[model samples]
Target: MPTADPASLFWFLFLFATFVWPAWERQRIHLRRLWKIHELQRRRGTRVITLIHRQEALSLLGIPLARYINIEDSEQVLRAVRLTPGDMPIDLVLHTPGGLVLAAEQIAAALRRHPARVTVFVPHYAMSGGTLLALAADEIVMDEHAVLGPVDPQLGQFPAASILRAVSRKPVAEVDDETLILADVAEKAVRQVQDFVRELVADKLPPDRAETIVRDLTEGQWTHDYPITFEKLRSYGLPVRAGLPREVYELMELFPQPAGRRPSVQYVPVHDVEPRRRRHP
Candidate 1:
């Protein structure tokens, strides 16, 4: 190999320092700026959208994203609470048709005893068991048209009204033993639920006011699906406020109302069945 010339080496060094190195450094700075820009966008975007529900499907293929609360929802609620910062307040956006009374009570109890304040925001409706939990919040905020329904316990698939109606329409001795027993249980369940509702509201309302609200909700004065409007709840003397934050409606739009039934398979292609021939030797 020929020995390197000083002139060639000098030119090479000058070109690297003058052009190549500057381009390389400039590219590196550009990359860093791009990273910061994306990072800033990600940070700001988090405030507008909930990061916990980044994907509609997180895990458990059949479970809902955030549609409603049921007896099965305790684990999800606990997980949400665990993931949240302890110092931050818990804001529950409720829109449910209610579920198991016990589960609703557990959720309500958690809200009542949380270390930080709990606020429930109802976008559309939170009925039956949903109303039970709303009572536990320090502040319940709702959209103008949002509703909270009665907390009358259901007997299996039938409403308590069916059972109560039987008792009201017929004398005790005239009714069958099994029917009488069921009616008694239903009456007791209604009373117990009313008392529980009162207790849940007592934290936010005075004892007398709480009693009135609970009585109205559980006395079967309204149908189970009744839309106890925001204005109606406010008149009941609970600390119910109208006008929810914008974020609540934004989140509501994110979830489509849950469809309980699986969609039926719409189409089936016609095909002929093949028959095998039997040979007798």
Candidate 2:
């Protein structure tokens, strides 16, 4: 058997310590930084809960972001809220395209049940399911360009407007039986959304007012994709304010922009075509 060299083993150990120690230390610091941020927000008021759907803008390396809201997400949020004191208020920072209706309701219910106030902040936009969540909050804060979308529910691949329109345009007897059934379901789906919205804001506003706002948002008053900007939302008699908490902007900086969106490297001249390597013969 060959004997191991003490000198070779010593250099190998030195190399490992030199390269690996820095990376390990950096990882610890990164985790600690995130923990400190959570602690800071917890001390200020409620622990801030962030829900960002993978928007094209937030996509990393041109890879789409994961869908924003889902059943599993609500469960995770429930566990997080329960970990904190019941009396503590919550600040939900939302950016979503909306998801399963049941999941949104589950999260909304949890927010309403919290003993303290719930505030939702939208640095960009929150649509559909996201709007459902914001409605559940005691107050909603958004940047001027931030928007919330209409709450009309979509059925499978069908749009609510198209389904209801098709049924209404043709006589009930003339319409296909399946189409009629879809139309009926669409009507019910709309009503459910309106009712849910009103109920979410009921504690904050009078019933009549809440119903009026909910109706406007749910009754096809706007396109499903319409950007209901912050100013317009304030007009709906909702408790909406302009601007987000300071930390939201600071945190936004931590996300990496795709290379195309980032500034050109300083070493590369603006007018120069990027250099490419030649194949060797």
Candidate 3:
């Protein structure tokens, strides 16, 4: 038998450490997440599913990318729903900046139709289409600092409401044919979102109150990226509360943001403590 050269062995070891090790680490992380998810399901006596999106390394090249709810996401979530028993409750941990309208609507519709209770937990923010999914839930549990965003439709980069307003200000004869066509589409997009949102909350809220909430959320009253905090969400008469299970927070920790630059926010980790008392003079 021929003996292997030292250079060949060194190169093999280097490649294994560089490629194989990282792959193993990622698989380990994935398994850990599944274990945590199972624990949450066991404790809550419900089927737990997560739709978490964040800046993470993607592909073998390790390119960092941010994700939104998409058709693939909808497919997986719908499949999960179908696999669950009708009587079993669903606990969805949602964290996204929103995504394609059709994908988000598909998820929302499936969740809304579930026979068992549906609860959406937001540890951070779930904006735009994310908010649409929250609206379909029977209960929304948000962190004190977590937020939801307006559901106003955005046509390309411009908001549909803004397009309508701009077109309304101009004389019909002065508006270009392309602009007029866009405005028409914008109007339809806004109306469609408003109607879907109204339908989602109809049974959950009084008719008059639901109508008001729908307008505020869909009429572009706020910017597309407006942060609707926990208090604001409650004020809108949404089924929202401020609190999260410890496991939910633990689950979030498992999905750490990708490493590259230094974190923008930092602070000492401390829990509850009583206020310091003033000493008597």
Candidate 4:
């Protein structure tokens, strides 16, 4: 290796420090700004907008923190909803894998208490406890492809986890015993969930229909491609209709519409202020 020229090395180091360091720093700053923007869009709302990212579990374990709400924190969300200005509609966005049943009910009850119309928008999937929240909404808006999972309640075992474990444990021979036991366990769990959901929906849906819905959701060993669409929900005995409410429609017109078929989930942050534009010359 050739000996370095001290002057040249100094100049080169200075150039790198002046140019490369600033560029790298700028890139990092830009990235941080972009991340801040995204987080603001996600959580910067004051209007008690609650997103149930994952409803299946309370703690952040294998699941992402975005999913589910802690029951206690969820109550705070409820209090916010209750205390929100009555003049403005409450926007509740849900995208959950479903969570603790009792927690779900508490959230649902808080939603029910909102004097302003409660609009639920599901941009993606809302299953189990998430579905229960949807039921409490005055209006549920879902995209054509968006889905709401069955309200069938499962007991101690998280439905997805339990099913996966059972499938994995199946024996090559004499699997009947294992299958039966799992089925029985699943049935009881599902029934418990359905009963709880039914109680919540009794005031909104007819008693007999609620019972039937619960049975339909829980009785089947497992609902593959569970009923989620409006047509399916109606077929399953839920009261839902297509088209946005007049107020929701008007709100959509005021904001920058989301790209695509239209987001099934629409939430107006409590802190959102109407943008003002100068009058044209």
By TM-score, the best candidate is: 3
State the displacement of the C-alpha of residue 242, model 2, in Å, after optimal TM-score superposition.
1.7
**TM-score, ranked from best to worst:** 3, 2, 1, 4
Show where candidate 1 strays beyond 4 Å. 1-68, 82-86, 257-281
Runs of candidate 2 exceeding 4 Å displacement = 1-36, 39-43, 55-66, 257-281
- Of the two candidates 3 and 4, the one with more favorable lDDT, higher being better, is 3
What lDDT score goes with residue 270 in model 1? 45
lDDT of 4: 0.63
The most accurate candidate by lDDT is: 3
By lDDT: ranked, best first:
3, 2, 1, 4
Candidate 1 lDDT over residue span 36-67, tens digit each:
43443354331111211211332224355554
Minimal lDDT window, size 10, model 4: 55-64
Error of 3 at 208 (Å): 1.5
lDDT of 4 by residue, 23-120 (tens): 68558755664454344334534243646443222221323234454587577767777677776566665667777777888888878777777777
Write out the backbone clash pairs for model 2. 54-65
Predictions in order: lDDT: 0.69, 0.78, 0.93, 0.63
Error of 1 at 81 (Å): 2.9
What is every candidate's alpha-carbon RMSD to the true fold?
19.7, 9.6, 4.1, 11.4
Return the clash pairs for model 1, or none: none
TM-score of structure candidate 4: 0.53
lDDT of 4 at 224: 35
